[model samples]
Target: MEFSGCWRNILSVAIAVVLLSLAPPLAHTARAQSQAPASSTSNENDIRAATVLFYAAFNSALHGDLAPMSAVWSHRPDVTSLSAAGGHAKGWNEVYAGFQNIARLYPGGNIEQRDMTIVAGKDMGYSVCIETGQLRSSEGPMVKFNQRATNIFRLEGGTWKLIHHHADSNLNEADVSASR
Candidate 1:
């Protein structure tokens, strides 16, 4: 009887731990559901604008200007990015630094979205697109950059702000940076 009671207690504790593990995501989902837009179309449209602003800021960064980038992104701890320069940056500071590195690596480029697709969920949205452009490398040579990219955004204070941006292409970090 003693051994059986101990096993039951262990089972109870295991169940409690599982429940606690699920709490954060469940709470987040509830908040998202409460704040979800009635119109998915409206959400998509808003996220479209956010994507446009993000790409605009991205292009500006290629031109060695980061001011616009700051305006489009959420300055939150969850912000993240995976850039062409070959690094995974997490948090706003790290992500911003990645953008700075892009500005340094390619002082000039214009990447335009092609074959784009956008999806919007409760308080969250994402866009997948093909990015095509010619970027001038740090060595002053122009190279074609074609990348599959994904941008994620979340509603913050009634504004859609970028939380993540990922881009991948053939050019490596060494090729992108002359100083490498």
Candidate 2:
């Protein structure tokens, strides 16, 4: 009878340990669910900011719309952009000038960004995806390219702005025109 009682006490202790271990995850899950709406709001805000940034790039490239571009960037000169050719453009002024150069070269061409994914953290977020566009040159037929890119954003004064951007084309000119 004493051996049976000892086994019962051991079983009780094991059950108590199991229950205690399970409590933290259950509490964590509950807390996460409670905060889910806030996370969702942040995600939506990040997506909107990212879309604006994409529009800024598109408009700056195609229509020379500096307003949209200016709206999505900080006035500070330290903002940076990394070109597809492994070149870096630092500061807002340099970045603006580079975009202008592309606009002047392309004239009436435009690129479209798609398949974007935006994820937000406490004060920062990342946007990643593919971009497709046509580049018209005075010397040849339209050139098209598909680029994969990642953009980092910082939230300042209740607005999210692009702090860094890096992009790379997936193909050379020879393969650029092939339909995917």
Candidate 3:
């Protein structure tokens, strides 16, 4: 009877020791599972807000205002922009210069983004959208444009900033009008 009691106590202690040893990893896994949905929702919200900011900045650029556009961009050396007006621009200075030229030429416009899909990761995201806009040229003629555009963003200092913009000007007036 004495030997049996001692063995039972030993078994209980061994089990407790094993459980305690496994507790950290188990707790971490449970915490991660509980937080996963919240984290995903927060990331989605951030991505949407960033996309809205991007459109606002694009509109500001369309209106020939560089301040907002400047604010939205990452301004890093790796930043890049490619558009009909700017051809292909790389680096902050080159991209800014391209925007300057685009602003000068396009002046103001009403742009509608359709079929936009945004995917966000830990610190980066990419969006693809169909941009249809009518731009009033500096000379006062309205030029309609339809382009497939993709934009890449990076999270910097807790805000999403545009890192790359690539747009194609393949669609003509007829194509844009037809889509409308």
Candidate 4:
């Protein structure tokens, strides 16, 4: 990753860590704060839709399909991601490669975000949430996956494109290991 991309990834992960430390009632807070003027609401709704697509693609990626992932991510040079499965990627190509690796390491599984808090600006937005589910590990054991993630998106050509994703393994779940 470039220096700027590294910094953005760090900041995004730090924000997610802080959010994870907070109590679990922020869903309502997020909804209330997202209420705004018509234009802002439209943008927020668009962002939410992008998030939905992201997760759908995310689950698909886990099962060895990367085509859906292409639709939600920006084909940019600055995108970066640090996966909970233990790898770092910089730029769109590298990021997609990382997902390909994930598809290889995790051939089957499901992951879904919870208590996501969305913050949308005019051109950029981010989401902080917990990813919980079961993933069949590379060793063929289904493991509980409790992760804290932060996803950053950019408004590109009137659509929200995911520009960065940082996922950290949270071992709060009993006997949970790295999903890799």
Candidate 5:
């Protein structure tokens, strides 16, 4: 009985925290949706720019080169990233540091984007991508994973800069190796 009560309390708290964290973005989204123009040519261009950013960022991340990633980012404090490894790194400084560590650890890494789809709003856009690649590590055969990713971008000034990025690995037990 005590264990059940404890579990329930923990679950309730977790849900509350998640909802709280989501509140700001949910509100921002609501505002954007209500105010932004629907189906504009600039929106299409924003999507194309965002797509380029995605490819460049992934390429930089794979090479462990911060230069490419930094080029696409806004270089603002609000920039954030969610990694497939369940790690959260916020801001350009911290993000760069994290990637630097990764580069040190895995010198020869490659990332491939597959089945990528892009959608855009007036000043916001996102891409659905499947990333499959290998990280060359000192340990064994290296680490490889296939992930379906959604990357969010915001139009900062005239340039499309990455604002919020999220990636989730498929983790399918079946041989996703063939897709690579």
Candidate 6:
């Protein structure tokens, strides 16, 4: 009976040791699981707010205002933009130049975005949407535009800034000819 009692005590101690060894990893996993959803939710909210800021900047650009446009863009050499006019600009200098040209050619415009979908990760997010707008040309003609646009953003200094913008005019040869 004495030997059996000793054996039972040893077994109990071994079981407790095994459980204690597993506790840290199990606790860590539980903590991670609990935090995952909250992190995802926070990222989603941040991306949504950034998208709103992007549209505000876009509107400012449409009005031929460059200050908000400059603020909205990342201002990095790696930034890029593809205009709805089918022109591509790379780097900050080119992108800013393109906007300057836009301001000259298009005095003002009204852009409406629809069917937008945004996906975000830890430090980056993208939005795709259909854009329809009308711009007043310097020649006093109202030019209508329909485009499929995608905008990419990066988190910089706790603010989201546009890194890339690509937009397709969605105009065929016939449409171009008709516009001309």
Q: Which candidate is the best by lDDT?
A: 1
Show where candidate 6 strays beyond 4 Å.
1-34, 171-180
lDDT per residue (tens digit) for residues 88-128 in model 1: 99999999988888888788878887767899986999998
Better of 5 and 6 by TM-score: 6
The residue pairs that clash in candidate 4, if any, are none
Best candidate (score: TM-score): 2
Worst 10 residues of 5 by lDDT: 171-180
lDDT for predicted candidate 5 compared with the true structure: 0.73
TM-score of 1: 0.72
Per-residue lDDT of model 4, residues 14-124, tens digit only: 999998877466877776677655667677777777887899998999888899999999999999999886777999999998988888887788988876778888899
17-101 in candidate 3: lDDT tens per residue?
A: 9999999999999998898778667766777677677778878888867898889889899999988564789999999999888
> Cα lDDT of model 3 overall?
0.82
Model 4 weakest lDDT span, ten residues long: 171-180
What tens-digit string does per-residue lDDT give for candidate 5 at 65-114? 67877778777888787777567889888766766776676777677677
Per-model lDDT = 0.85, 0.74, 0.82, 0.83, 0.73, 0.81
TM-score of each: 0.72, 0.75, 0.72, 0.73, 0.65, 0.73
What value does the lDDT take at residue 98 in candidate 2? 66
The per-residue C-alpha lDDT of model 3 at residue 66 equals 80
Ranking by lDDT: 1, 4, 3, 6, 2, 5
Clashes of 6: 0
Q: Count clashes in each candidate, considering only residues at least 3 apart in sequence or on different chains.
A: 0, 1, 0, 0, 0, 0
